[model samples]
Target: MKEHHLKLNVLENSQAFLIEAVSKAIVAENDARNWQFAILNLVQSLELSLKSILAKKHPLFLYENIDNPKHTVSVTKAIERLENPMIGGVKFSEKEKKGMSSAIKLRNDITHHEFDFSVEYAKAQFLRVFGLIVHMFRHHFDIQITDYIDSNFIESLLEIEKSRVVLIEHANTRMQEEGVDSSLVWECSNCLCDSFVADKSKETCYVCGYQTSVEECGKCEDYFYSHDLRSIEHLFETDFCEGQTIVHNSFGYEPISICSDCYVAVQRDIDEQWQQRIEEDEYYHWSVE
Candidate 1:
């Protein structure tokens, strides 16, 4: 029981670390992409949670009466085997499993590849997993992680995540050995009808026909495939420059992917709009109109 309590404490602390890590990833500077670091931070949290359940050389999960050793049994051996998918671990129910597993898969998509938020997917996953993690933290630790994590820890994770991007280059070279460029690839949901995957052997989307000539292999980092595009939207969406794109690279993150020229153009327009709005707000105190 003492061991269980201690492990639970560790898990709580890890959860705190995760929530903080994700918050930092949100604001970090890097050239890789946006939202992914946050997504990866969440992934690390789930991995920690999944690994915690198997502390006893246990296959996924097994339970025992701490004092009555005879009560040890495989969790799956029970007809009541719990399945929780949000974290891709077994718990006790199909809903729990599906919710968690799907969240993890979404996190994996943006973390390990280039992806933008799907309003439908991102909001649902975030709300569910955040609730589930918080709930479990309370059940196990009698503490709340949101209060536990501090700004200092978040700042640290931001720095660490930035550093990790360096190692990614090496990881990409490794993928080159596999004849794929790890940079231009990602993993997406099976329901993808708008996009197609070229790396069937790895079952990942190359995601390369437009914004780049490089076909990235999601399974590993390696070489890139050459491609061509006629319109920027075919590869680079209009959103890329019009504040629709997010980028992560060695330099840091850009919330929008605009060329310096276009960025300046938009900034000028934005400045004018802000000034206009300010003047309007000052002079036109609105009545019900």
Candidate 2:
């Protein structure tokens, strides 16, 4: 039990460091000279947080060779090992894994090459990096890091998001000038960037490199709100969809025609109910025979 507690402490501290790094990165994004350092710190935070997760399972896991004991597991090795369930590692979705790999690539580029880093690129990378961090925290630690983020950091991200939207709109305008259909335009839910070209059978966001999926509403036969859109709410919402009724026809349930507006209202009600239930459960501490 004490060992478990110690591991938890390490994880908590690692997460704290990660949050601090992200906050600093948001600030540095405003200044061209400081932005590179911010990227370095963010990458370092990712590596440390990932290792801490592996360490939580066993301190020996952090070591590359348990017998020789001279080498520690590298960030690349740690991320690769995480895919194997037998090693007590969390399973990452393909997109999440891809995002992590991209961050690693960015770190290498910045460290090894004469890289030309731009504010736009950094903003996109930050979204991907922080998105993965948020996922890992929830799945591995069962903690909400958004609760720990300060208002100023949130405001900074909002500003970046607005810029992203403008960039996307400009790109779309160029595509339209080239005779691309306007109906093929899709907004990226990850960065709130409207740079996705839906003309192809499969579409990906040009700005953030996030993949997009089109879901059809069962009632209207029109495109329904996507899981990516829900990701935005997950990032900003306090409870993270604790009781939200995601309009999916899973588990033999009939699909409903939930407009986006109606879905938002239903999600709000669900969140309220979930909060009340959590409070009641904590107060009662009910035990069943």
Candidate 3:
């Protein structure tokens, strides 16, 4: 049988890390210094929880090099091992993997080097990592994560999550009820959520209250956030590589922002041109024959 006491110890340590993370996170809202440590503790909590899950299979799996067995595995390696068919066979979605990878990188940056993070972005990342641990506790261990942490601290975290969902839902509801055009709704540059409303007079994010003016795509003449447009420019250079001087072309074709539609249209035109050239070459060969 698996070492039941060892599993319990790992889980308790994981909860301790989470509790410490929560205390830091609460202070981090106003105190910038605490954000770094909060994130570190949060990642530590996630790492220990992952290790506990892996420990169920074998204790040696916790080590970075199982053959030598000196140090514990990093979060990334633990995740990779968990997904192995012979080891754990736990399936993680692409989105989950991306979030976890980002959290791990953030943890490494905070631990090894000086770093700065905006509070809003930090909170979003903390929640993402915490959600992963919650999933493991609830699904794998059949225990609610909220039951392990301080009720007051967890309430604040849950409130943040609830508010985020409500903001998106409110924006979507407005879109549907007001008969707003779907094209007018875009991803918010601030929160990276699909809650930005680009009305004619004003453009604003429903979630984060980030406001910016809307601009038309040069080629398509469709409205889009200024940041969303891709600027296309022509350049002239004598030597293409190896430290060559390059200048913007002054052939009266000013740099302009192109939307995705215009980009796709240009690609389609090029494809059609290539097809026409191929057909002409085939016809010439037939005539010569």
Using lDDT, give the best candidate's number.
Answer: 3
Cand. 3 TM to true fold: 0.65
Assess each prediction's global lDDT (C-alpha) against the native: 0.46, 0.66, 0.79
Give per-residue CA lDDT, model 3, range 1-289, as digits (tens): 4578878888889989988998888777745577788888989999999999898778889889989999889888999999999998999998789778888888888888887766656777888888888899887789896688878998888777787788778878877887877778887655657777898764877667778888989887888777677765432212355676454332333467778778666556655666777899999999999
- For model 3, the run of ten residues with the poorest summed lDDT: 232-241
TM-score for all predictions? 0.35, 0.57, 0.65
**lDDT value, residue 245 of candidate 1:** 57
Estimate, for each residue in 1-289, the C-alpha lDDT of model 2 and write its tens digit: 8668757765666667666766767777556456666667677778777877887777777778868767778888888766668775577777777677767887888899888656656666777787677677777777776666677777777787687777677776767676766676676554445666665464666666667566654434456445523322331223326676454212222334445665576566656766887888977886531
Steric clash pairs (candidate 2): none
How far residue 124's Cα lies from its native spot in candidate 1, in Å, is 3.6
- Mind sharing the TM-score for model 2? 0.57
lDDT of 1 by residue, 252-285 (tens): 2123333434445545555666677788987777
Candidates sorted on TM-score, descending = 3, 2, 1
Residue pairs with backbone atoms closer than 3 Å in model 3 (clashes)? none
Candidate 1 CA-lDDT value: 0.46
Tell me which of candidates 2 and 3 scores higher on lDDT: 3
